[model samples]
Target: MKIFLTLLTSLFLFFSCSTDDDICTDGEGTPQVKIKFKTFATGKPRTLDSVFVAVDYGAGPVAVVQNTVATDSLMLPLRVEDVPFTDIYVATSSTGNLSQIRLNYTTTSEYVSPACGIRRLYTGLSATLQAPNPVLAVETAQNEIVNESKTHLFLLF
Candidate 1:
């Protein structure tokens, strides 16, 4: 009787400790949008000496990249909160020319794991280029950003 009680208690403890927390370690989250730079005249890939990217608000602007040198490609993060729309501003220099790009997408809750709960996944991606645009054109290579390898936009300047 003593041996049976001990075994039962051990099994119960093992099962109780093994919860969803152990299985949710591989939870995936939203990925950043990739942008590739190109020459407006040549239509080929080019590198910028420095570029600034940020989100602007009525009061001020939040900087994503400030005076950072980017070669060929850059990964820009999108807003993952409850908001469905994100507006990003990009500049070639610190006090040089700038442009604004608006990204509109739909968000859906995805079940990652019980421990991780849910994460927001964006789809139906679209972009709008605003005035004072320094870019020659914008091309969307990938509309859905599921991984880091995905290139969302190509900017020609």
Candidate 2:
């Protein structure tokens, strides 16, 4: 009878000590802003041979996209702090001729899960092309950035 009770207690303790609820598996997190490139004349998609992107979150500037191959879409992460805008720099080449673009938006935090913590969401999105050289114009596609599935902005070249 004592052995049976000990086995039962051990089984109960092992089953009750499970920590599966602490693991976040839904992939709920901050979403990145998606930008697609298009030609200014034809209004069609344009593939860049070499593209470089840098953004300033809090510190100076940090490179986000440095690709040598041709690509038409880019994913950029916004600022998570209390700043209302994010400054981005795009360059067709790595040497010079960097165009500045500022992304303005309002951020809100939502609780995802215990393990995932809070995630930031942006709304009222707008873009201003401060320098127009390689990038001719900026177009806002989506006003809110809730997920990475949709294009938020379009860069006309």
TM-score for each prediction? 0.76, 0.87
Q: What is the lDDT of candidate 2?
A: 0.91
Q: Poorest 10 consecutive residues of model 1 by lDDT?
A: 18-27
lDDT for position 100 in model 1:
82
lDDT of 2 by residue, 1-157 (tens): 9999999999998887645456666447899999999999999989999899999988989999899999989998899998999999999999868889999999999998767788999999999999998899999999999988899999999
Cα displacement (angstroms), candidate 2, residue 20, comes to: 6.7
All models: lDDT? 0.76, 0.91
RMSD of each: 3.5, 2.7
TM-score of 1: 0.76
Give the clash total for candidate 2: 0
Which residue pairs overlap in candidate 1's backbone? Answer: none
> Which residue runs of candidate 1 sit more than 4 Å off their true CA positions?
1-27, 56-60
